[model samples]
Target chain A: MQLKKIKSLIEIMDEKNLTKIDYEDKDLKISLEKSNISELEEDNEDGWIISPTVGTYLDRDKPLKVGQKVKKNEVLFIINSMKVLNNIVAPRDGIIEEILVKENDMLEYNQKVMKLG
Target chain B: MIKKILVANRGEIAVRIIKTCKELNIKTVAIYSKCDKDSYHVFLADEAYCVGESNPSNSYLNADSIIQIATNTGCNAIHPGYGFLSEDYKFAKKVIENNLIFIGPSLDVMEKIYDKQKLKDVLKQINVPLIESYKLKEFIKSKDKNIYPILIKQVNGGGGRGIKIVSSPSELEQTIKELNKTLKEKFDINNYYVEKYIDVYRHIEVQVIADKYGNISILPERDCSIQRNFQKFIEETPSSINNKKLLDEIKQEALKIFQFLKYDNVGTAEFLVDSNFNYYFLEINARIQVEHTITEVVSDIDIVEEQINISDGNKNEKETFITPNYYALECRINAEDPNNNFISSSGKIDILNLPSGRNIRVDSYIYQGYSLKPFYDSLLMKVITYDKIRNRAINKMQSCLDEIIISGIKTNIDFNYEIINGKDFKKGNYKFKKY
Candidate 1:
């Protein structure tokens, strides 16, 4: 059973692009943790990066019509966290492919507030 | 009688002050740095404003910005909780000038006690026992006969910043040079003094509450002998000193100092007692101490409330006095590596399991998914335990520590366990220097 658990961790690491996994069974626990160097680098190249700040979603509030061109660093929405209003900017100069959050909605940190293509 | 108060700080202390204000039915306004936008205190306060950038010099320490916030918010008072501008006499003066009560001592009183050397002079005038030594130049002149193994301390410093030990005359010059550089760079004070180093001495402090009506009361002494890097890590009450006479004498002296200072509000007088039972007055903390919970646990007096009331010109209820009833212990759980020079570690808290039971209390602002910031003190939580007996209190504290589960961030929990189990601590035969 221990060998099988270790084999499964290795498979999960490759399948999901995950670096670490903590598992526990009764008193016997194991942590297959990887270094943080690769994880930080992986954030630069992403398919759909979520907004790291909390605020209201602008794109979702007013759905972008088809073929809307969004410039790089153009604020797509604002996430207000009761303290500061964060301007969620586009990751790259791309088209607004989709919107994920609604207006006047509470946003969580690092949640997918919007999607930019 | 403060209708509104502006907290001139951020993070847990701000939240703590806000909670006290809420209990007193006082509206609270919090001023936060740009980086602390999502701080819990900002959400908990009735109103909040952005002061400036994340750096302390620009935000929390900016007296002008804080005064402006308080004036704009229409706050009648401002509470500078402990750090930043808490001890700044100029800031306190500014608050008073703006017709806002600074929830601390008057500017004149603060100025009198802010400098360590000046405070020592005051204690000396009152016949407080102080270690003997001379200035650096005097010691350098009389090196052979005057100078011995002594502690080199900065004249205007606290929190163990510019301090060193010189064992012999040969190393005196170099040590002084280094300490001078560090003192000038850190505290901007080039003055230095030397004192006889008291080895194997227990650090004990008495918490005193003095009102404007000239009534002073001493709330039992706390033994903070367990320390790391000259900073207190664990504090306990009913210090295994069973000598009733000695305890009474120390309490009387502490009260005498408070009376002499004409101090109005809460303060702590620290002392170092050697193996021979000879106690020497170290210094006075003119503000709320970190280990105040130990006293509160035994005394059953809400010190924060008392300070607020006293500042508002309300008299303390004479019947509501503090007398030590049982033993209490407080362990400061810091986010630092015990094995490595106590270096701080910052990360998100993945899991939190605080212990709760009879007479066990945990004061913290941390929750699951909360990130430990690297720009502040490493203290993550303060766990206090109380019992009828000292040994039982220690045992309960150990059990509580064992039950606490903190992941993602490495804490000094393991070191705390080692300290509670160590022979010197178990026997109550420890000193602050051991840390």
Candidate 2:
């Protein structure tokens, strides 16, 4: 019934390698089918900025906003793990495509934090 | 104090380091190859990353990727375990360049020790016995059946690579060509030298430890003589040498090398002992070796913990010469079907039964339902036992091996059984034979 629920179902389908899913409830009935083709290849003439540790991730001072151009060696964010603050640096010069994480979000080891191109 | 550390190698050593880190309250980051996603080391770490693909050149050996992972994961230090980048000069330099702690010898010390010829020259000054290694070209061109029995060894080789024993001048040319071809194809290495092959020899290594403050300690020597094709399967400490005088001499020689080099952290200086009890230095392994477990049990010291503490600048505060209180033996079990000529047995581990109880420790990375990739070393577990005497230790080790059970994949457990329960092993007379 809700779009968020539908999106979550699609994610489960992807994880389970399922092509179709059916659901029926007191007030909702739905059947979704996924096409065989994989999604678009990510364009990152520059690759993604990935999280290096398991911790709550927070942006650097003056919060990094998406669509901003980043230079090589720039401090993008900080991952605080076991009481140590580690800076996540830009591997090379690139423009931020999207920030996949929010401030104070718990990030697993090596999670992609930003897409760069 | 290190809050988090990255383990850059895989297999039991990675798992071993993680256990120590957990004991010291240090967080650990594990890096694995794509094929090793299900590896025990990955599942044991506080956090894990897929560094690269299954091919070692792209993953475990990918120094840059490992460094990036360490920095990204907030690791303040890196433990290069043993093999992958343990003695790498450039990688150690890079780690120091990034201001992260490298838990081994400094690049300067490593370079000095890792240069085999230079190390020999340096140690010769201290009266350390060393076998003469001939120049490659001289060895190739010489008409020396006079030096008939000789070994062609790669300059930078380990784990049984680039080693061929030639008995006659007639076999020299063909063997060198074959070895060079394999070395080039696998390692892109082309350098090798000729050393007089000792037909009958014993492998003895001295375990040495040093702190940054120059305090060095030498532990009891270990007899790593029992091997198949140069790969050690059984290792024992308190070498069967009942003659205290000769054993003491061996330990002193090892200590002299350690002090002379100002070596730091844990390392073992290997030697080949001839029948007359004369010792000759083979090389120095500058990392936490796989057989370190036996030393731990015998000496009652946690080597990995000491490594971490020393990295944090601990001053070998408890430095002292160590004489093992108990005799210890280790059996290396691998996922290989020995019946089929040691072909790798890769697949799901369906059932598992591990040995426990007094005087026994089982170090392994496999679990029930764990599947293995065919692209790595075959060592699956180490069964170590300790007791008041060597005979008791050997018996305990055989029992431990008998108690281990894992189905759905063939293992060399029985091969280990023969060694531990065999007459030659009990007699402590097992020595390497020419192929």
The best candidate in terms of DockQ: 2
Model 2 clash pairs are A52-B72, A52-B73, A53-B73
Cα lDDT of model 2 by residue, B271-328, tens digit: 8888877778898988888899999998889999988888888888655579888999
- TM (chain A) per model: 0.50, 0.59
Estimate, for each residue in B214-303, the C-alpha lDDT of model 1 and write its tens digit: 887788888888777678888899787656677767878888888888887888888888888888888887777778888888988877
**Alpha-carbon shift of residue B366 in model 2 (angstroms):** 0.8
Residue B179 in model 2: shift from native, Å? Answer: 3.9
Error of 1 at B298 (Å): 1.0
| Top candidate, metric TM-score | 2
* Docking quality category of candidate 2 according to DockQ thresholds: incorrect
Instruction: Give the CAPRI rating of model 1.
Output: incorrect
Each candidate's lDDT (Cα)? Answer: 0.77, 0.81
Superposed on all Cα atoms, the candidates' RMSDs to the truth, in angstroms, are: 11.4, 10.5
